[model samples]
Structure formats: structure tokens, C-alpha cells
Target: MTTLPPDETSQAATPAIDEPLERLARFAFDWADTLCDPDHGCGPYHRAWSMIRLLTKNSALPAGGAFIADGLHRAASGGRCRVLLAGAADTGLVALVLNALRAQEIEPEIVLADRCATTIEQNRLFARHLGMRFELHRCDISALTCRPVDAVVMHSFLNFLPVPARQAMIDALSRALRPGGLLIAHQRLDVGRRKHDPQPIKENRALLESAARARGYPDPLARAIGAAGADFWSNTFAHAPTPEAEFLVLLANAGFNLISLSRPLAAATNSPLFIAGQSRETPQAAILAERMPPR
Candidate 1:
């Protein structure tokens, strides 16, 4: 566990590091593009928008507005916070959160890290347009060293990871934050009615195949299913849904004292997962030590 030195000065430009993790991150971005395109039926960007709308309809604010408001409140309470916008696939949620922070008069030094080069570039362009400065890192969350941050956010990105990977990522994030720092995450967590059933990889493939057919893709549904199956086994299948208990345990292990968990007003039953916690203590060293023995 080598720790990177923290950026001390407010508004200082933090330099980006080019490492193996960064390269892998670039690869992930490229891979993600295939699935995220609007043409693709399962584009996470579109899915996230749908989820957001379902969550915050009651409030005058938009779907992700509550999350932004929560973060802003936390930053206001803590003062001059260093925030990490982890897995900022697209800039939609990040923009909302940043806007909320700005509204509260909190000068947040934001670090935007993600695996997608296109998204990173887009975010960079967007930030420039807004006259804002952010440190961009192209690296996987697991590969990142646990530097102290006042808060961390993962908007609609955690569900993409497998169960073990999600836990590992969360643990890493917990380590990255300073004591009492906030961890804001939004994802769909219900195993659906098929909780015991394995992720309907085959079913999802069928859906993709049907989508391809409807779109009149050159490839037949069988071929598309086969290709998607290959991709799933090779890449996406490793990630699993984090059970609610597991998620809570991971937070506790990471040293986060649960502050709040909100259910979406529009579709609380359908949307089983929501914002989890704002940690109040450093994660218990012993629990982490037991789970991850020193290499």
C-alpha cells in the first residue's frame, strides 16, 4: 500500500499519472463504448437517466438532484472538501453533484476518475466550458491507491462490477476517504424476482439479440447472442449484484457509519437500491486485515 501524496493547495492542478492501470482503464473505456452507444439496447447512460427520473419525481429537483443535494450538504458541513467522482461514465450525474456543491458555496477540489476516455474527454470539455478545474485520472478504482479524500461518489457505475469486484472496489474507496468522509453511490441492487437464479446472462443475451434483429443488424440473432455470450463470459459475467446485506457489511468494514439511505419516490418497490451512507469513522482495520491478509 503505497500512498500518493495529497494535493494540498486549493485550485492547484494535479498532474495525471501514466501507469499500467491507466492503460487498462483506457481499454475498459473502449470496451464500454460498444455497450453504451444509444444503438445498443443496454446503454448504461440511458438506463441511468431512466433510473434517475424514477428516483426523484416528488422533489422539485431532478432524479439525481437529491444525491447532489446530499453531497452539497455534507460538503457544507465539512468545509473545503476534496471530492472524488469515481466512475463518472458520463458527466450527467457528476454535473448535477458539482452544481449542487457550487450552489452551497463550497470550493470542492474534484477528482474525476473513470475508465472511459471518451467520457473523460467529454467531462474535460464540459468542465472547461463551466470554468471549472478537475483532475482527471484514467484508472480502475481497484488499481487506485487509497489517498485521503473528503468524499467519494459512484453514480450508477457500481452495478457494472461483479460482486467480489464491487466489494474490492468499495473497500478501496473506503480506504481512499479521510475519516468521516462521505461515500455517495447510486445503483440498482435488486436481484429482481430471480434472486436465487444466476444473472440471466442468457436472457439478457436473448434480449440483445432481439434488439439487434429489430434494428436489422447484419448479424443474425444467434450470432449476436453468441458474440454477446462470449463477451459476457470473458468480461461482464465476473461482476455480480451486491446483496443488500453484503453492501451494508462492506460499508461497515470500510469504516463508514451509515448516515442515510433513501428510496426512490417514484418507484421505490421497483428500485430497491438507493444512496447508502455518509461514513463517520475510519474503517475498522481489523476487519479489513482479516479479509485481505497482507501480501
Candidate 2:
């Protein structure tokens, strides 16, 4: 575990913002609505529709749908499968997962969980529009009771929680799965500093240093480097670019047997870390107890 020195001023400067999430939701809804509106210019709707089409293209399912489909397929073989979608705001991932399962002729009982009332309403509306059945729980995941589920899929939710909260959430998710059941989670990993042709490290570091100094920080250069390093590790290692080693260790600790691990095959682009594992009969609580270095 790598630890980066805390930058109090920098931390204070960065406000808690959910603008990214809201922007994404707005984009999706706006794009979909525009495309469906008959009066809209063909150009705008065409371009947006094409993008959504490309995003959900079946050809990409092999890699994009593998984690969720693997669990769904396993549950399908057993005749009945109950799936839990933690923090399934807007049901974007849920739509994909359900589409994949439906393609395989598997009817999965889904429980969509999230604390946001607006998001819950949106999910319910979408589900109604699609004529699909799902139980929506408007509550924090931590407050929920653990029950036997065939699978649990968490997409980009763990990273928002602090380390301890993340660990507890993982433990809860693991316990929710029945023995031999599947757990699919997607996280972001942090990538290390690398030289770029168009954008050199010197320029990037200098810009960061300037930002730190502007925020009234002392030793801005060192502080900038430390901040950049922390961001890189958190995004690449802890959240986005999660290493296989760390993932394996995490699964082992959670009493899960690794079934498959996959990364994007295409050239580097923004993508989620896809992982799948199975709950074990003999819980590995000891492994979970092993302390990991701070992020």
C-alpha cells in the first residue's frame, strides 16, 4: 500500500462534487429523449443515437458483458437467480446486464438498490417503460440486511466510499452471496506517471505546481508532485487501473475464488475494472483481516 502525504490546503480547495454523475445522467437522458423526439434535427439525434448504438452494440458484449453475463449464466443453469444491483442509479448498467441475460433466455430477479430518491424514481420509471420487474430499495447499502443472493454486481460504487467503508461494503456484498454464488465488481485503477509526446511530464507537473501555489500552499513543487502521485495511484491502482495482484488478494481475503479477470483488449480508453469471483464455503475471514496500506 502506497501512502501519499496529505495536502490540507489542496484537500480543502477541492469541493465535494457529484457534477460528473449528474452530467452523465443528464447526457444519457437528454440524448435518449432527443433521439426519440420526432421534431429534433436528424443530425443531432442521428449522431447521439449512433453513439448509444455503438455503446450497446452486441459485438462488444464479449468483453463488456462477460463479468455480469458469467454470473447470470451460472445462475441460469441453476433455474433461478436473484441478483442485487448495488447503487444502480439510472439503471444504465442494469439495462446492459438484463439485456445480456435476456439474450440468453434467463429471467433474473433483480433488486436495484440506491439511496437517491430521484435516482430511484428514474430507475422505476425506466423499468416501467421497459416492462421489467425489479425491487427498488431507496436506502444506504450499509443499512441493508444481508440475504442469500445468487449474484451481486457493483459498478463504480466502491471507489466513492472511504477505505474502511469500502472494505465493509465488500464484506457485506460477499456475505450476501450464497456459497458458490458470484460477485461482480467494477472499480477504477490509478495509473503511474508516464511520458507523453503531445503533453510532456514537465508541463503537466509545472501546471499542477502552479495550481497548488495559487491555492496558497507552501513548497508547491513538492506538494504538486505528491498530489499528482497520489491522484495517479488512487485512479490507477486503487480505483480505476486496479492491478491483478491487488484484485486477487482482495478476493482471497473476501473468501472468494477467482473465476475470471479481464481488462480492456482495445487501445487505452476510459473503462471500468471488471472482476468476477465466487463465494467459498470456507470463508477466508483471516485474509480479510490482513491490513492493506492506505490509498
Candidate 3:
């Protein structure tokens, strides 16, 4: 267990503003203008993503860019690697992950697994259009039976699960990785402490707008986020944010070494990328090793 110094802040926030804008602009261009509706309690849940952008333009870690390509490239060295993107919402992020892998010339058997049927269908089209090939598994991640892999990538998916389910998912992920495998997740670290509804609409809008501005969002987009705030809180997530320490404990107990935790974007959850690895001593590692196909 690596003892990391305390993080500078723990407040959770969404992904940098550009990702949603880009996705919407490209795929749902018609709705791009009003994606953030003022009537909604300010869309706290809508498009409130928090993950490092893998593309080079926003590759700065704290500037809403991802740093996983290098880590993953190193991990995937030696041979072809199996990678899982659990709870894959759409193929948008998957495209970026693919770019990273391709950049390293790492031949990966990529699995985009999620439970939503509609999402799966949509992703098929998205994947085909992007000319990327991957296997799509449509089921809850906790229920997946999979080959052990070198790495798994997640974003804002675990926090919505109930505690028990979340734990099971972690266990399942542990079983799905080889010894020394990495689980890189971008998660919300402070949502549990957020104030729920009963707060007036005006106040909520003001709060959302403030957050948007703090992260340097333009006035129009900031106002749109404020507009969607209410809907975001009510409909977006199923569970409160998990404190970083608690989540780290869960990772540790599950036999993972905490390699890094970094907040690359601004959002309510301090959406930090957690890079964790399976250790040889963990019970899951022992079981997984036997089940793993010969390297």
C-alpha cells in the first residue's frame, strides 16, 4: 500500500467543459445549443463528466487532460493486452482510449461493457463510424465473467452503485485482471457531502453558475449548466460521492496498490483519476493466476 500525501482538495467537479461540448457538437449538433436547459434545476447530472481528456489538445493532467496513455503503454508492454472499459456509456471515451493504445502500438483486445441495451446499440454505431473494433458486453459489470486483463478504465461509474454492489464490482474487477494489472478510474470524491433538494431553485442556479465560472466556462455555457442543475442532481447519479480515503480503503482491502490519484478536471466530485494495481499477495490474484490463460 503506497502512502500518498494528502490531496490538496477533495471537492468533486465534472469533467472539463470541452468534452461535453465536443461530443454534443459532433453527435447531437441540433441540441448542442440548448443542451443545458435553464428550466432544469441546472443539470447537475446532465453531461456532468469528470475525466482527463486523452487527446493531445487537452493532455495537461490538471487542465482536464488525461495522463493514462503513458502508464498504460508501459503496462501493455511485452505482448498484446486485454483492456476493459466498464460501464461504457458511449463510444466517445472509448475512441480516445483506442487512440492512446494505438499510439503505443499496443495491440489490445478491447471490451466495452455496459448494462444499458440502448447504449450498447448506440455504441455499436459509434464504434463502426469511428472504424474501431471492440467487443460489446451488455450486462452489469459486477456480473461479468471475463478473461484477466492488463488494465481497466472507468469514469464516474462506480459512485452510482450501492456500497455492496460497488464492492462486488471491485472484486469482479480484481478477478478480471492479472497480477500487477491496473484499474484506472475517474471518480467523484465528495458527493456524499452535497446538500440535496429543499434548497431553492435560485440558490442552486447561482451555485452551479459559480462552479462553471470558477472552472473558466464561458458565460453562456455556465448559465446552461446552471439551468440543468436541478435535473443533474435528481436524475444523474444513483449514489452519493465516496470520500477518497474510504474509496482508497476499499481498493486496498481488495488487494490493490494505490499508484496515483489526480484531479485533472473541475467538477463537484473532484473527479480524480485513480490508478490502482493488483498485488501478488491478494487472494484474488492467486485465483486469477490459475484461471488466466498462459502468457
Candidate 4:
């Protein structure tokens, strides 16, 4: 993918976020550097440091920002909107949800869950900024259980898990929501994908380098993270995405009914590779689903 000019894109829509985005990018760069001191063994998603840089460099606002806004507006019935964020690497989604809820005059009861402490702390930055109350959890979201909420939100998270775990996560999140609760997310999908698929850094180096240069981050040390990521990319795409049909089946088996699913403009998926003539160009789609109440 050729680099889209940030100024020519949607970055201008979110003003004054450059400062926080820089701080987060710098922190992620330092952490990624630590993961590479001896080797890439620590895993890029260990603290989701890789994602912070990639997100800051490749995309301005979260791709699911519009879905989050519309979902909340659709679900809010002049009452508090209870939400559960299944996983997050930054404050963008949470901030978007909060801002959208506020616009609807709906008080939000939000619970944000993730396994990485760094990301949990990273998400806290926005909580502090928005001055919104948030209940945070550091754990595998697939194993998470709680009182049913009104909706569950995520952004490109299902691809991080193998297909079985991905389904388990859907089931778990389904149980966490009240009957007829919403499941909203942006996910990459294609056919015949597997976790053991080979993903060479060579394929992504050009894309990474282009993004790194386009972002032109102010911090010099952090600026090198794109190169570092290209070199130490063992953890990049360590998992596989679900097939589109299988994903729909999983949601259905988990008692969810599809509300809407569509690919948004300028949004891309991570599974862009070719192995043995089989293409892995998984595309991203914005999904809004509702869990069916037991009869």
C-alpha cells in the first residue's frame, strides 16, 4: 500500500492529538527497542508496542470510529450505555466511544479489558484526559466473564487470535453482554488462513518504511521504530484471521445476528501476503451485530 498523505487524509479531523500520539509513539518505540535488544523473543504484541507505532503511522483515527459512534447512537435509548471494550492498544477507541456517548447525552458505563499492562496504562492516558470513569481489566478477554453489558466493542483484535480462540472470545463476549447486546468491531477476513502461515518481513519493509517516512514523527529515537519493526518483525501477524463466512457463522453460533457489515474507505487489513500461489489479502470490514435473546 502506498503511503497516504496524513494531511490529505483524516488526521486533520482530530486536532491536538498529535502531542499524545507522539508520546505514545515514543513510548512504544522504546519498548519495541527493549524487545529487540537480544532478539524478537519478547513478542511485538507483548505490550502491543508495535501496534502503537503502526497505528500512529499508518492511520489517523481508529478505522472503527464511525461504527462506534453509530452503534452507540443506535443503541442508546435515552439511558446509560453500558459498554465493554474487549481489547485495546490505545485510547482512540475508548475516546471515540466516550465522545460519542457524551454527544448523545448518554452516560456510559464502560469496562475496558486487555492482557497487556502497558496498553492498559496507555489507555489510562485518555481516561485521565477525558475525565471519564472507566473500569479496567488486565486479562485474556476470552476467559473474561462479567455481568451482561449493553455492547462489546473491539478494533482489529480478532485477527490476533487463532480461529478457535477467536470463536471462544466471541462466545465469551457474548455471555458478557445482555441479551440483544451489540458486538461491534473492525476485522480482517479471508479464506483458508492459518496461524502457521509464513509472513516474511521483506514483503512489509517497503510499506513500513514508507509509512515511517510519511509520519515524520518529531522524536528522532522513535523515528527509527519503523525500521526496527521491519527488522524484528517475528511478532507481526503471529496469528491468522478468520474467513468471512466462518466469521459470520461464529457470530451466529454465539447467538449474534448481524446488523451491518461493510468495508470503510481507506481501511486495510494486515494479512497481505502470498504463499504457494494462495493469496492472503484479507480485507477489513466494520461489523455491528446483536446477540439474540434466548427464547
Candidate 5:
């Protein structure tokens, strides 16, 4: 792998964010740093406690990293490629990517994107630990300015944006990619009717039960967690689910050709992986006309 000076600066000016979002992002950054930081002792995810690990999706990082590495290999530019890794704050996913790239003998110029300042700092530390270099873009995805790159890795991150903004972000990302470049995105589908519309109380209850079992918790603790399903869902993801079709249409409108979309795991699957290509062919007009209007 080749070496270069790491740049931790954002090219764009700081975008305005609401105070609530700002606080939430900070809290999320602190939570991640506390649980995943190598300098910190007994990081919960590091310890593999089932509740936190499952809640945070730490177990999926290895597979996600391999999927990204495969795409990078196909791009095939050795150490000279430029790649963007977006939305990687929760786990050691960056470290996994760095190791995979090293094994392939490729040291691409990397740009790491996140809204959280501490998350950006954590990424810098991981790069130092891995001896890799990256430029940090410290702004929300919706506010990002596009730059051409060979590949982009987005993992279960864009869902937080409102629908229109999500589409705009995808369009920007597509424009940012070099022709024939790859984009790997993992998103949780909000499709089909369920027992709960926005509040996944049933699922949360199951998760609590499983978590309790994993931690060898007594029945009382399990009952308490199970009872807090509404609060958990509200605090975690308060937005209404995005219809899966909306997501596909957004990609189509952004001029990407969907290459593969993994089957969503049982309702348990939070995000299913999608690999797409910036079309070498002309982008067909978005398929909006072909689908029924959203309910």
C-alpha cells in the first residue's frame, strides 16, 4: 500500500443544522466513541454483548467490509484509485476496509464523510492505527458537495434523510462517481404492512427478550425492556418508514443501474445490501411513470 499525509479537513463550509439534530449527532458520536474506541476499556461491542452488538449492527461490519473490498477490486486501480467511504461511525468497519485494501495491495485516496465531529476524529484515529490516510468531510450527507471518485460506500446512513433530500443526495453521489464506478449501499426497507406501523413494538420486544437471554438477565429485566418498546422505537427512529419503491425510484432518478439487491432478512433485517453501478449507458428516465403512486 502507498502512503500519503492524512487530511482531516472538510472542503465545504459547515452547513447549518437544527439544534436537536446537532445534539443527537453529538450524543451518537459520544456513544460510538465510548463503546467502540480501542483506547477505552471494555467497549460493549468489543465485548460482544448481544444486546448492544445486535442493536448497533456490529456483527455486520465484516461482511460489509468484504462486500466493499470486492467492489474496490473490480474497480482495479491499484493504489491510485479514489474512493469515498460514507457513514462508517458505529464499528471497526473502517479498519476492516483498510486491512482488505492492504491485502489487495491498493492504497486508494479515501474520503470519509460524516456529520459528527467526534466520529470524524474516531475515523482519523482508526486510520492512524491502520497506517492509512483519508480526507474527512464533516457535514451531513444532504449538504455534501460532490467530487469525482472511483467508488462510494454508503451503509444504512441515507435513510435518516427525508425522501426528497434522500433523492437529492443520491443524485449528488451518482454525479460524484466516475463513469462505471461502483456504489455499495445498505438500507433497511420500509415495505409491507406490519403489526405496528412506525413503532415496531413486537420486534423490539423480541429483541429485548433475545438480548436478555444473551446477557443472562433475569425475567424482571427482560420484562422491563420488553415494556419499553414504544419508548425505544421513538427514541431510536421516530420517522415513518420509507416505502421500498421510493428508494428504488430515487436510485433510478439518480442515474444508477442497480446491479444487485440482497433479499431483506426476515423482518429482523434492518438493512439489506445493494450494489449499483454508475451506468456506462445513458440513464433511462426514472421509472416513476411505471409505478403506482405511493399511498
Candidate 6:
């Protein structure tokens, strides 16, 4: 019934960016990351992440509304829907995903599965604001143990997994779905990037600091946040990239039948709702798959 928080979206963009929502989501994620990440986060790291994410997320940020809503319609034959969100960095994505369900006028029974308590809690608050029916459980995707649901939705979530963990994560997602259940996702592709590879660190602290400063953050705050974000980003790039073919293979291996794998094209569906935040850094494809009946 709502799109992403209006502030995180651009009215000009397909899914208007909601600035205030983005700010709150960034801070929540940074706080969670500092607490849960291997880097052992501190106050500085949290602040840095909040600033860094807001500036840098432009490339990989857009999670559209229409594609998701369409997928739900296709997967569900006119009834209340049950959805599982595998993992998300912030509530921004959650709001965008839920907005799709809202637009369809479906009151979804939603479950959020994540390892971060703060991230889960933030979404809980947002869901409550809308009076949605939802539940939160703290768990890792690779070892997901939730009841089978009608659909599992993810946004740019594949590459976040470390290469070794990708297989387990995919399998877990499959397991989380019921027979004929759907998996709807949009993921970025890095051509020819292989398993076990790590994405090279592209931006340094100086660059992030410069970006933050340009966004009107003060000198000390900008530099500190930039440094923290730089280090945090470096530590989290274990999944270098996923080639298109490789990603398809993972889906197939998980017992999913491809429904559609598309780009945001003029004549194709969901184009109006897709706000492409993916630049050269994170070109994306929309994927909808179904868990087929067992042989």
C-alpha cells in the first residue's frame, strides 16, 4: 500500500528515493554491522557506515516495486500471501519490497530472517507502523529453518554472501519455499567473476571522505565516517562477483525452475516501477523462479 519511504526514493525515479528512510536505514545497518561484523564495530565505525552507505549506495540501491508486485500476482492465485525476506542490509529494501505487496492490495504474512538483531528490529518498527502482519526471527540464511512460505524475495542479496557460503544460501532459500512457491530477486552481475573470488576494493577513505564532504558533512565527521566505511566495505567484499551463467546454475541446482529473468526494458513489465540505482558498478537483472515438485 506504500512505496519505499518517500524520502529514500526520488519522485523522478521509478521508485522514488526516500531520503529520510535512507538515512534511518543506513544508521541502523551501520550500528548492526559494527556490532555483528568481524571488525568489531565501535562508535566511529557506525557513524562512518551511516555516511558512507548513503553516498555509495546509489549504484546498488534501487529495488523496484512493480516487478515484485507482479511476481506475487503470478505466484499467488488471489489470496493472502506468505513471504519470507531472506536478508537485507536495511529497512529501505524492506519498505520497497512490502510496498509491492501493498500495491497489489494483499495483506502479506511476512517473515524476516536475518542474523542482525538491529536490522530485524528496525524492519519490525516499520512493519508495525503500517499495521502489517509480520514476524522477526534472527537466523543466518545458510542455515534458515523457517516454515515454508509462498515466496522468498531478495534484492541484490546474492553477492553479499561469501563465495563458499553461496551454495548453502541458495539451497536454504529453496528449502524455505513451499511446492510451487516463488523466488523473486534482482541481482547485479559482474561479468566472469568466479566463485571464491573477492571483489577488489575500489574506493578508499579519501574518496569516501570527499564524497561525504560534498554531501555537506563536516570535515572531521566526514573523514572519520569515510575511514570507517572504507574498512567496513573492504572486509565485506568476500563475494567478488557472480557471472550470469553461474547465478543461473545456482538456481537450477537448488531445484528451482526459472520463470523469468529480465532486464528493465521499455516494452517489458515492471519498467515503470524499476528505479535503476545500478550504474556501471552494479548492473542488475530481475529474476523470478519457482520451486518445482520433486521428481
Off by over 4 Å in 5: 1-63, 191-234, 264-295
The alpha-carbon deviation from the true structure for residue 254 of candidate 4, after best TM-score superposition, in angstroms, is: 1.3
**How well does candidate 4 match the true structure in TM-score terms?**
0.71
The clash number for model 6 is 14
Question: In candidate 2, which residue ranges exceed 4 Å CA deviation?
Answer: 1-63, 190-246, 267-295
Query: On a 0 to 100 scale, what is the lDDT of residue 179 in model 1?
Result: 65
- Residues 1-295, candidate 1: write the lDDT tens digits: 2222221211112112111222222233334445354432333332232222222211111134445456546644445767777775455445556656666767777788766555566566556766777788776787777457777776556666756677677777877776666777654354421221234444444544454455454465335333433243223311455565676787777666666554442221211112112111111000111112222
lDDT of 5 by residue, 169-254 (tens): 77767766777777776444563212233434455556655665665666775565444433333333223555657777787777
Clashes in model 5: which pairs? none
RMSD of 6: 7.2
lDDT (Cα, tens digit) per residue for candidate 4, span 230-268: 444444554665777888998998999998877655433
- lDDT at position 87, candidate 5: 60
Residue range 1-295, candidate 6, lDDT tens digits: 1112222221213333233555564556446554464542323323343344456544233444567777877766466778888876656556665556666777677788877666666677666666665678777788878888888888767876777788789999999899899999867666422222122333445666677788787898777665565455444333567777888899999999998787653221121112122122224577889998878
lDDT of 4 at 276: 23
Better of 2 and 5 by lDDT: 5
Global lDDT of each model? 0.48, 0.46, 0.51, 0.62, 0.49, 0.62
Residue 67 lDDT (model 6): 71
lDDT of 3 at 104: 70
Residue pairs in candidate 4 whose N, alpha carbon or C atoms collide under 3 angstroms? none
Q: Tens digits of per-residue lDDT for model 3 on 1-295?
A: 2322232222212332123423432232223224434442222332332211221113222211134454566468485767887774344456556656766777767777776544455456555665666788877787888777788776557766777777778777777878888777755565542334435545655765666677676798777666554444344344666677777767765677776666442332222121112111110000011122224
